[model samples]
Target chain A: MTVRELAALPEFEAVCLPDGEREILGGYAGDLLSWVMGRASEGDAWVTIMSNVNIVAVSTLADPACIVLSEGVAPDGDTLERAKEQGINILTTSLDTFDACVRIASAL
Target chain B: MTDKVNFHFDIDGDNFTSAGEASVRIKKLLREMGFSPDTIRRVSVAMYEGEINMVIHANGGSADVDVYGDRIEIILADKGPGIPDIDLAMQEGYSTAPDNIRSLGFGAGMGLPNMKRYTDDMRIESALGVGTTIYMTVKT
Candidate 1:
């Protein structure tokens, strides 16, 4: 499924959809930015509770299809702006990281 | 791209929010230069990890990227407290970052290893109480 379709789901809310058309080939759940940066494949839906600006930076380097912020953790103003500026897609959900990953996996 | 292309940035140690700006810009530049995806990813990921380490440990540092015809060289220099034991710091799960850094979703002790994992060659020079300098190369 593409990021736009995933965002359209009831469970996930779109925070920014700059690259919504990108495909989500898989999912990676991790909060450690370095781990995710090294392991998350290109076009994977990265699920994390990290809402810091560094998340945006990681997304840029990793080229994740979109960032799935779990546990209803929303990106702060700076992070949101950076994601938008960098054209990185971002989604938020009330579900925890595991649930968010499950939903994304099922959709994919 | 006949001549060597070079980029330099002084990392701001005080701002965790801006830590990866240099890496991001280098990624874009590599893309614009039409480098292969695999090559770009390796170079960018290595540089990104170096940038993060600089911020978390050395209060900030300088990053230099030199794009040559065959390979890309990344040099990171920091003036913060140097790594006393390079071998220990290079271990995959050994990080000296403070708890506050971990709270920011980093400090998993994977930075140096990840940098090495992505690059074709890596080396480090550090002095106690002086600083650290890392040199990494990724072949295109």
Candidate 2:
């Protein structure tokens, strides 16, 4: 599914998408960095509330297909810019992190 | 088709956010070298965990990576208070990191286990108040 599809899903609404070109997600969530680093597969959609540049760094390391920022939270300026620069698809959903993961897992 | 390549990095302990920079660079380098994506991911994840541990526990450390035809080896050397009980420390859900680190989404006691899970081989050597050194390898 494309990012547009994910946004269109009932679980997500555009909180603050500069552009709607981000792609859809494929996988689920894990908060532990090392756990995500070990288990997250490429092209997976990562759901997390981690709001830091390191989140972006870890996303790149994991090569996730997209990142879904849950709980309607917004990323820092540097994080958004870096994500765009890296061509990483990012989205924001009003759902809390747990709910977001459940919705995404069911979707997958 | 990856030819042998060598790389070294100095992990800075003061800055938690910058911890994975070296591992990210290495991941990029391995990709550019045409290593299979799976192999690159394993090597990168394992090394990244080791790097994070260096920063969190050792205060700082040096990492050496050697890419061979069939495997990638990473040696992490740290000068922090060593792990007194390797057996206990190796248990899942065992961590010395503070609550602050956990809030950052790390220090879940998954670091060492994840490193072992992603790598083909791993070893640790340490002495109290001296430091710790971890050796990990991922088969390419």
Candidate 3:
């Protein structure tokens, strides 16, 4: 599924969909930025509650299809701006990290 | 070495939010240079981890990227307190970062290992009360 399709789900809300057409091949859930940077594959929907500018940096390096902020967490102002500027897609979900991953996994 | 492309940036220590800016810029440069995705990812990820370490452990540092025909070399240098135990620091899940840093979503002790994992070659040099420098190379 594409990032747009994942955002279209009721549980997920689009925060920034700059690259909605990007394909989502898998899902990775982690708050540790280093671990996510090394482990999250390209085109994976990265799920995390920690929303910061570094998340944007990690996403840029890892090339995740989209960042899914779990448990209704939202990116900080700088992070949102950076994500939009960098052309990184972002989505917010009311579910926790595990549930968000399950939703992304099922969608994939 | 004389003909290779080189880029340098001074990493800022005060702003944790700006830690990885250099890595992001390098990623863009590699993309514009038409590098393979795998090679770009490896270089960018390795550099990013090193950059984060510089900001977290060493106040801040400088990063230099040298791109050759066959490989990319990244040299990160910091003047902050040097690592006393490189072996212990290399162990996963061992971190010296403060609680506030961990709360910022880092400091899980994966930085050095991740840098090694993504690069073809890695090395470290340090002196107590002097500083630390990490050299990493990723073959294209």
Candidate number achieving the greatest lDDT relative to the actual structure: 1
**Pairs in steric clash, model 1:** B13-B59
User: In candidate 2, what are the lDDT values of residues A45-104, reduced to their tens digit?
Assistant: 788877666677788789877778888877778777767665666778889988887887
Residue B100 error, candidate 2, Å:
1.2
**How do the residues A10-60 of candidate 1 rate in per-residue lDDT, one tens digit apiece?**
999999999888998898999999999889999899999999888999999
Measured against the true two-chain complex, the DockQ scores of the candidates, in the order shown, are 0.92, 0.76, 0.89
Q: Taking the candidates one at a time, how many backbone clashes does each contain?
A: 1, 4, 0
lDDT of 3 by residue, B1-140 (tens): 44799999999888898888899899889999899999999998888888888888788889999999889999999998999999999998889999999998899999999888999999999999999999999988
Candidate 1 regions exceeding 4 Å error are B1-3
The global C-alpha lDDT for each of the candidates, from Candidate 1 onward, is 0.92, 0.81, 0.91
Clashes of 3: 0
TM-score of 3: 0.97
My TM-score estimates for the predictions, one after another, are: 0.97, 0.88, 0.97
Q: Provide the DockQ value for model 3.
A: 0.89
The whole-model C-alpha lDDT of candidate 3 against the native structure comes to: 0.91
Residue pairs in candidate 3 whose N, alpha carbon or C atoms collide under 3 angstroms: none
